[model samples]
Target: MNMEDLTWGQFKALLLAHPNLHLQFKYAEDALVDASYHITEIKKAPITSVDCGGVINNWTEIIIQLWEPQGKMGGDAMKVEKALSIINLVEKALTLDAEANVKIEFGNSTFYTRQMYPSAIAVHGNDLIVDLRPDVTRCKAINRGGSCVTADKGEECCTPVKPKVQLIDLAQTNCCEPGSGCC
Candidate 1:
């Protein structure tokens, strides 16, 4: 993970520091979420998978989905306290991992729905803005000195190679047989 990766604990700490400020989200350059946005849901996903390096990986993520009311156009963003209250409510039903990775799920008329990582968090005037960036894909094998790609598409990195066995002269040795006492 990069320095831009935000954890659940860090996010909560940020909100606690500026409880009076309005919370806003910025997905792209100069692009911000509608002021009427709402924190609809908080999801905790536990993921387990095998990577390209044949390594087993496990991790968790906390995804917060934002939705803008279509009828409500221009309004002030919700306060950090309100958002934190929602999180507190969610915690009552589920145990959240503070160290889990954090993601923001959002979409608009022009943008498709996607889970984004928090690239930056800054205080601007009376608002606290969270800058989000699209999540990227990388090969774990390449990071572990194994090739991410193979000459043959059917081949994968770190695939186990089968061992070869040699034939022995069974008749010359006291090998077990169907009706023999050694069997």
Candidate 2:
């Protein structure tokens, strides 16, 4: 199933139902998280803000942070059942918004720290694969409306204009030169 189709709570419920399945994270086709990484923390962040154009926006996110043990022997990756247990423990302490967006935060010596969303989730054999996708900055005002200035149709708003520049050769004409109007 598409990860984008499922809410954070729905995804957690799915993981809980598949107790025997193993979990694997894929940042890209060739790059994958270490097999020893574990889910260290789950955070609920409620963000409210105004965009560059003064449009107010609000959203919530469930941030799942993953970490690999330091200097440890080879360890098996976290199992789906174990992950469910961790979620259950977290749910008891803090209420999680089921409709909130889900994001996974991960980093290592080779990979820079980033919070990415799951682009896709698939069940292959005994493993449940989560393909993480990076997020990009976007023009929120233009997205929410037609233009940053107004939502009216056929109206041009905030069109970029090239700055006018004048260039003069100092060698041919200078302020210090004769009859150059220097004090």
Model 2, stretches more than 4 Å misplaced?
1-6, 72-75, 151-183
lDDT of 1 by residue, 1-183 (tens): 363567899889989999999999998888899989999999999999898655788899999999977875766799999999999999999999999999999998888989999988899999999999999887776775556654455576656666786666778766676664444
Query: What's the residue-level lDDT of 36 in candidate 2?
Result: 83
Worst 10 residues of 1 by lDDT: 145-154
> How many residue pairs clash per model?
0, 0
- Candidate 1 stretches with Cα past 4 Å from truth are 1-3, 145-183
Task: Give the clashing residue pairs of candidate 1, or none.
Answer: none
**For candidate 2, lDDT tens digit of each residue in 80-106?**
998888999999999999999899999
Candidate with top lDDT is 1
Q: What is the C-alpha RMSD of each candidate to the true structure, in Å?
A: 8.2, 5.5
**lDDT at 15 for candidate 1?**
94
Question: What's the TM for model 1?
Answer: 0.78
> What are the clashing pairs of model 2?
none
